[model samples]
Target chain A: MIDKILSKYPFPESVKLEIKEELEKLNLSADKIKALVDRCYKAYTQNLMEPEEAAGIVAAQSIGEPGTQMTMRTFHYAGVAELNVTLGLPRLIEILDARKTPSTPMMTIKLLPEYAKDREKAKEIANKIEATYLKDIAEIEADIKNMKIIIKPDRKMMDVKELKMDVLKKKIEKSLKVDVFEEDEKLIIQVEPSYKKLIDIFEKLKDLVVAGIKEIRRVIIRKEGDEYVLYTEGSNLKKVIKVPGVDFTRTLTNDVWEIYEVLGIEAARNAIIKEALETLEEQGLEVDPRHIMLVADVMTVDGELRQIGRHGVAGEKQSILARAAFEMTVNNLLEAAIKGEIDYLRGITENIIVGQPIKLGTGDIEVTYKFGGKR
Target chain B: MKVRLQDHILVPKHEILSKDKAEELLKLLGITREQLPKIKTSDPIVKEIGAKPGDIVKITRKSLTAGESLFYRLVVD
Candidate 1:
């Protein structure tokens, strides 16, 4: 039965063997095998990428042309102040430029199965992750006459955070390396009268962390589908994933660099693809994922993320002429000269500049003439 | 801090080719290490597979839209 199908179709040897192996495993008749073989042949031929095709140029145009239409604006979180995610053209530029830190980093935290379904548990997790500073929960006033910094703790905020006054006083005493005393409800941090700079001490007291995770600025618990998801304003993927209740498998961050640091370059590559695709789609542009994949692959090909322009992939091109053509032409040329570098003229840009056919497509082929042919 | 690169969901299945197989692959593709798609020697999969510079590594990935696909990269510095 396998021999009959093999002889009937002009499939490759590998394809024929695959069909034979598959047929032996399944209880399929001759008719079904024929249909399966036909379908496989169609799919294989449809997916083949032609050799010598200028794929890079096509990908560039596919992404770059629509890039012009993207609106130049950062999207503010709805009804939230100072929480803006860079989107549209600016974000697209950032992704391609391979910016180390995004303008507004964020994370979407998914809880473990047991905690995911409960709102109260999710809120508890949010409180544990959200960072709170001393200034956020206290009014610190500077008194020049007494040479003291007055810290008036918000009792309601302290109670909500489950913080004790004694702990707060001890924390301040230890962090500032100074004596702190309570008068009524106010905690007074006394600066030495001989201390010349009383204002410096007051500024330092305002920025101290009072509670919660350091990197996570805000965490909002919002129910999505069947689970309560925590949307955070800042990203701390490495630390956040270690939280006991976090579903590390599904927890994701918008910062590519954070992903790289926590999960390595492979995750960073995937993040680049996702971020680039979202940026384009947000502006109503339709592009093949393969193009984005190519870009991501190029950016992380060296096991590190690199921008498309100078100071990254382009600047580090092996070909001196290629680097010169990109930007800082005179600087590149001078450096290459000093280094006594050799330009092999192998790449597309260098070849084109010198009026030679690019080493791509038809130019990649070489036709050598025989000394004496059978004429 | 040590990062577990192999545990990443995005990392594909990777295998190092033996000397003969690597030579055959290069001859069949008619390309040098510089011409082939590059994978850094420091890449996690390359480190996991114990592949050296100039060695060929085969990567297999399962894509939802494209099903299973195979790719090759030459390990480089």
Candidate 2:
């Protein structure tokens, strides 16, 4: 049936195969399948990029034109209160800029099948993943006379964070290197007699991450569909991917650099494309993902994430005039002049600058009429 | 890390080509070894697949423009 449709409509294999799969699931009649395939074929044909078409400029304008309409706001992500994500133009710029870290880095973590549906198990995972500072789960004070830093772990909060007293004690002991002894329901760290030493211990202990990965500031367990999903306030993909009970395969983070570091450049390129498309889609703008893919390919083709702006892609252009046109016009032109640079006039921007037709689309062809075809 | 590179959604399919296959691919694309994209020897996927320097890695990714697309990279230090 699919072969019949394919032979008639000339559908791409991928699209045709996908349609056939959906049709099989539907138990559709033969005529119905053909009609559906026909409609899909039309849609596919319309979307195809034309030969010799200027895709780069079209992609730029496709994304650039709609980008103006996006609001420059940090949206409350997915209606999850207090979780602010940089959206709209700023985020698009951030992705394109290939910033080392996103202004608001976050993760969407999936749990293993057993832990995914249970609120308790999900909370446990969330607590284990979230960075829990001593200040967040305990009360601390400097006893002036005794030269001691007293930490009183909140029983209720500790329980909620799934933290045990001994585990907390060991972590605190390991980090501070001072033996902790319990006195009157408080953990005490003896410091040197100097007032400065007491102050030092107090400050140091205050910010100690007694539980979980330090980079993950907060992990909220929100029920998404049938499973509880972990949405994080801050991202720590490297550490998070290693945590037990996390469906490591399904975990996602917005830190492209982190992805590059942990997963390599291929993954980073995919992230760039995925991130840019999401940013555009979130703003209710419809831009072909291919445009974003083209941009991403440029940014990551060299196996390193290079920004789209002056410090990266534009700055490194082969054509002097193109680079000069992008930014730092004086600096680029002056440097080119001093170096006796050659302008090939091969690139679109350089050709346009010299008042010549760019070697693109129709301009690329010198003769409209070809030599007569052989009989 | 407990995660396998293969399991990561962002990572595309990567396979190292034999010397003869690599030569064919380069010739087919009408490009030199230097012209192909470079993937660092230290890259996690490169390390995972045990691809050495001068090896050509064929990457197949589910692309947005075409349903699937092919990419080649020169493994470099």
Candidate 3:
């Protein structure tokens, strides 16, 4: 049935086959499928990149033109305290640079259907997400004369976080290997009677985890549209996904590297594009998604996340001259010569450096004439 | 043990194309394995399906802007 409709149009074999496959996927009846096919065929024909078209240059211009209008500073998430998200130009640069850690790492967590509707469950989730330190829930005072640390438990804070004083004392004792004594309102931790040891012990006491997950410093659950979504200041994609009521499939971290670690290269590629476009869009700048996709593709074609600039994608180019043209010119050239590396002279940068047309579009093809002509 | 790549957010729908289907695809496209996009043999999904180097893998993905799209890759070591 698809073949019959597709045969009516004098389309390329590839186009006809692709249209047929797409129509089958649409799963429409014969008449509807044919109509959709015609529409798709029209769209495809209109969208074809022309022969000899410089796609790379066009993509660069498309993204770079709108980028100039982007705002410079980060944007803070509304209602979230000091939850500043890196946006606009800086964030775009960060994504392309493939920074090891984002300036402001965050997670957008969705909950399971049951938990999504309940306010109480969302609060519970928020509490679990907010990392709790002993210093946050207790008043600690170091007595130099006695060589001891007194930790006065904040009963309200402990109660709110659902933490037990006894459990906190046990954890401190195990981790710090200090003698902990339970008093009426305060827990006394006996420290070694040396100035240096006492100082060391006092420092370790400050960062002890009293309750809740680590890494996630703050979490705010807000109702967007209908469901309660969690916006966290810190991110731990691997651990957060393990939480019982989380909609694991939909939860995402803004940190591309973290996404790469948890979800692999393909997801990282998508994250890079998403992050770049979001940054641009936040500042009311618009660029084609195809351009962003091309950038993402270049960054991840090797099955690994790589930055666009030096120390990553640029530095690792197969052509030595191309690498040298990017940065550290002398160093690159010297290293390449030392290694007896051969330049393929295939890439755009290398070809352009020698004042030749780049191997793209028309430049990518070659034609040779035979001495004898066939009759 | 390694985590399943199928659970990855952008892995898409991966299938190991049978020999006959792969041959037919190559004929239809008028291209060789070298011309197709490359997927590393070490890639988690490629490994998950137990595809060796030189085998063809078909990937179908839902693009936000382009709807459903298909891609082919030659698994390479």
Local accuracy by lDDT, each model? 0.80, 0.87, 0.82
In the order shown, the candidates' Cα RMSDs to the true structure are 5.1, 4.1, 4.6
How far does residue A362 in candidate 2 sit from its true spot (Å)? 2.9
Give candidate 2's TM-score.
0.86
Residue range A1-375, candidate 1, lDDT tens digits: 768766876565556667678878997887888788788878877766778888988899999899888887777443233456778888888888877778878888889889999888888788778888899889999888888889999999998787888889998888888899999889997888845667777878888877777888888778788999988888888788777788777788888887776665666777888888887877789889888888888887776778888988788889999999889899999999999999999899999999998878888989999988988
Q: Looking at model 1, give its docking quality level.
A: acceptable
Query: lDDT of candidate 3?
Result: 0.82
lDDT over C-alpha atoms for residue A261 of model 2: 91
Per prediction, fnat is 0.23, 0.70, 0.15
The residue-by-residue lDDT of candidate 3 on A1-375, one tens digit each, is: 888888887665666667777777888898898778788878877887888777778988999888888777677553455677877788888899998888888889989899999999988888887789889999989999998889998989988988887898898999898889999979997877798998888888898876666888888888988999999987898888777788787888989988777665667777888888777776778788889888887887666777888888778889999899889999999999999999988888999899988878878889998889996
Candidate 3 vs. true structure, TM-score: 0.84
Grade the docking of candidate 3: acceptable
Candidate 1: where are CA atoms >4 Å away? A1-28, A35-43, A76-83, A181-186, A194-196, A368-375, B1-65, B70-77
Order of candidates by TM-score, top first? 2, 3, 1
Best by TM-score: 2
Alpha-carbon deviation at A96 in model 2, angstroms: 0.8
Better of 1 and 3 by DockQ: 1
